[model samples]
Target: MPTKTDEERVPNFGYAGFRLDAPDASVAWNLQRGRSGQNATGDALPHNPTAQTPRRGAPPPPLRVSNPKVLNYLDDRCRVHKETINLCKSVLQRKSIDWISVQRNDMSNPIHDVDLVISVGGDGTLLRASHFLNSSIPVLGVNSDPTCPDEVDELTDEFDARRSTGHLCAATAANFEQILDATLDGSRQPSELSRISVKLNGLQLPTYALNDILVSHPCPASVSRFSFRKRSNTGESSHLINCRSSGLRVATPAGSTAAMLSAGGFVMPISSHELQYMIREPISPRDADKPLLHGLVKQGQHILVVWYNEEGAVYFDGSHVMHSIQHGDTLEISSDAPILKVILPENLLKQGS
Candidate 1:
């Protein structure tokens, strides 16, 4: 609390009484709690990309402790547990791990970084591994179904339409599974949302997720047209909203409290807030169930977005493979990564232990 008008600066190389103030509060978004905030608690990531190519001079020491791989992105949709894949591959072959082979058909060859990604399946295979490892990487789902529609569910014996609603939240985050068993027993700790970069078309997609970022319209119901954007402290906003009905969302805060709280949208909790991922519009389940008519869009807000699509498909986590958005393309979304490096399973944090 210092002042001369309070002084302001953030330039680095050293440090100095840095300062900033002028924001009181306006960050409560829920487009369905923005895609369920990435189940077991903590999803929606991607704003921490500043270490890309810096260091023409010096600075290099702490970067060699890597070894994590047992990713099984649904291996033909589901069925993993040969003793948990040989005890997580014997701890990555005695800690010399290097995995990759959970193919839908293996086009495989698109990884930027990885230190931990052992998703087995369910919760849409961990949002297709946070839509293809955007904030570099950090994942561990392992719920080959034992009731795992939520929280490593273990009731599976067979029969599905999408059963296993005894959730702790995986796909829909149905409930947050006691914070995913306190984040695998480290005791509740998923609050790392702030890294996001999906400005499709002019290409700024340095992706990262926790659960929420979709733009569908492969119409089985129709009403698909799109647009809606906002950037603030109190400055940029755009619009053209239409989304022919039931398909359009952008969520984070571990997904606005889970699929934005089941598509009614709004459930932000896990603090420090300033959410983005609310360019919503979902109207064509003929018109009223519209938002789940699969969540469509088009309301307006743009510095760029010339979209025109002939029909839906902008997935990112249904299993990363984006390359089908037309009419002039531009789908930029922003919130940016801060920090998230989790490896839970010590006690999943602990509060009911």
Candidate 2:
């Protein structure tokens, strides 16, 4: 793995995340797993394609995305994506950074040799890229569609119709060059974002969620039944609850503003080391007392959930990774994952604080 001490380490740039083809359609993302069959050249090749012939002088950088045409729906976003790529090309030409083009689905692609990773889309892009990178490599997010108007015409309008990801993204395509310059010059410090790790049946999973994890019946309309307990530092079960609800969510502070917030969960400050759990639409029987539905999971507290639904599943970061659960299976969640280093403009870093 390339570290800060390696002089040959170069910045790696990529674009990922979900694409909204139309205002009325539900947003979707690439869900492919492991080493992708597609190469950085956007061709059907192996993970490391050495035979890809660069065209002429200054060959275009590797770009990986399923259906790049999805950007065509929004003229501004399409332009932003193109402009960001052009800016990256210019920087690559002027600097020693190495260009990395990868598909959103290639989570096991080789990127450990990279010094920094630049995600060129929204929050989803950064989230996907995090799975493919080493913890030591900091990530920089570029908000491609920052021009979306601040005000929405209708309260019921879809969130995507109004703003594109200005909240989660730190740099705009227009000023990314300046931010990159400062980052390379050592004038900027990266923000450290905490992540959540999950274990199934006492074995660790391959991925972690930077946002939140959803545990529920695989069928959306079905009810989920589970019992969970908080294991204290002394190895004793401190808090326990039996839940009958739509699902449950475990989130980090950085993920508080995402799905958890939409489900009536509170937002934690970006720097919080604490984790939170919430039950979704719990059901109370006529004679039984309702279990505690929501609460904070302190820094070292461990949450263990026993599955009662025969066909339940656990979704990490909104389905980026899904693990099937069977009756009596136990899933553990904690704040023990690697700390993610996210690059941000110094000014925005202060604003986050």
Candidate 3:
């Protein structure tokens, strides 16, 4: 049952770079059925998903899986090593199961639980996998890159993998659970969850992030009129920063070192450390002729972030997307979820690939 809309919406079919090409249509139908929830307009648009559900719940069912297969559809026809695929096939075959290579839009697999999800790429691949698996399933991250420095590689590997080494290792989704446990245990002392604040129209969000949450401006490299309430004066909420760059970003302890760092934002430790908002390449009005900020929003306490472009999109974590952010709309966003646990290698070297 989908929400009523001007035009009929058929579950979540492929919009941009994803779609279900499973063995049959049942997977698509079930996925549509599962996601057939309400949309932003209160109108029930089946297949439309709301932001992250934040009330603490019980642990998700354990994933039933066989050895993992690695694929890099981006590299050659596939980037996954032929050997890894064979390994997964061998293990799955032993269990009378056939391993299907994961596609970009395999999110509609309809399988409730997977025993394990092993990534053979970098952090980016893990991020995308997290989205496809939803927050319920855990993943084992395997770094296949060899050129990375020792210190950086240690966090993602589990086996004794060599640099650019062809080693197989593991890291669990335990980190996310630890962060959640700490949050519930009243140990915000060294919290890893990131606070996400998104203001859409008049909707200011109090969200959390397990990965990175970013705002993509409609215009490229253009300054925009964004407003926010600094943590200092809680009651007095009249502080706005006409940032000169494209957009603002709020990263979790896990993602703080990612895009946030690339944009010159500080990198907070993955589990502790407080790294607030990282503002990037902002425009200065002193040169009004250039009008760094396309426009500004000075409404009530409600922070309004506007994107005035033909097509603007926002990337949550590295997986989800909301493509309709526009003018007259306020986006108040911050991290809303805890860090997603990704298995780390025990040896932090060539053993874990």
Candidate 4:
């Protein structure tokens, strides 16, 4: 007899885009590498014999990109790409599994027929790839730099400091092969990461955000006014909350650890089905201004926000892809979409516990 968990496991042998590598400086390198003949390579790099590694029975230290930029950012990331590709090839060759790979810039709908989707880069790459997927296909994220330890002593003005560290990534290049094998063989379980669906004035938006959705004033440092109301389980709604703040963020559980956390919101469990909204810098000093600063929306409940400002914008998952909101425009956000099945390692589950 099969166990209850075993009955729920669905194995998808085919995979797509399993090796997109990115670092804090990948964006800069991608733009200028072709012009400068700069190449990122991981070969000839020395191993950190002293630093304890993961899955080899050694506990990993606090993995922090303190400076936001890692050592030899571009070259190291290139090395990560090289190692990741090699590892991916080796795993597929060993298991006789065929896989398809795509570049980070490809925007076409190419993975509709594929069952499994893999993102090889950091969190940005994962978000970019998810835009093309809307079905129930499971996604696995592989962190390119797992045990990378490089220190840059001096900061330069010309070098870009923005880092693309994969804080939400579950597997590293060193252990992705093993994780992939378990997922293929129906040994590893998948977790449902719910996504937030957005609507623009009664019209459905094309893409949903796996992370948080940001609504803000078009001009920076301007006040954003909006009125929001939530429909209850019985289809009843309380009085509308007139909000004055810098912006608003409606985030899913998977996005709790990102901008929501930095803004002092609660860190929700990745598997939670509820959605949370935080009013950023709520602007009111009066006692009567006791608005609902932050709260959670149940799975079936829907929250509608109406823009009161003439210049307002909506960004999905912090991407440049956006839709403008004008005065009296309504945006409805809900957690009614199908869950995103993300392949997580056993160790991640243990840590969460």
Winning model by lDDT: 2
Decreasing lDDT order of the candidates:
2, 4, 3, 1
- The residue-by-residue lDDT of candidate 2 on 35-106, one tens digit each, is 345433234654564656556776455445454332333334344455555565566557655453444453
**After superposition on all CA atoms, what RMSD does each candidate show versus the true structure?**
21.2, 11.5, 15.8, 13.6
**Cα lDDT for residue 253, candidate 2:** 85
Candidate 2 regions with alpha-carbon error over 4 angstroms: 1-76, 150-160, 285-291, 345-348
Number of clashing pairs per prediction, in order: 88, 0, 64, 5
Q: Would you estimate the TM-scores of all the predictions? A: 0.25, 0.74, 0.50, 0.74
Native RMSD of candidate 3 (Å): 15.8
lDDT, candidate 1, equals 0.39
In candidate 1, stretches whose alpha carbon ends up further than 4 angstroms from where it belongs are 1-118, 121-125, 128-130, 133-145, 148-197, 208-211, 214-248, 251-261, 265-353
- Residues 116-140 of candidate 4 have per-residue lDDT tens digits of 6667656766776667666566777
List lDDT for all candidates, in order. Answer: 0.39, 0.66, 0.39, 0.65
- lDDT by residue (tens digit), candidate 1, 59-143: 4323221221111222212222233333433443453334433332222344454444544324444444445444434454444
For candidate 2, what is the lDDT? 0.66
Candidate that scores best on TM-score:
2
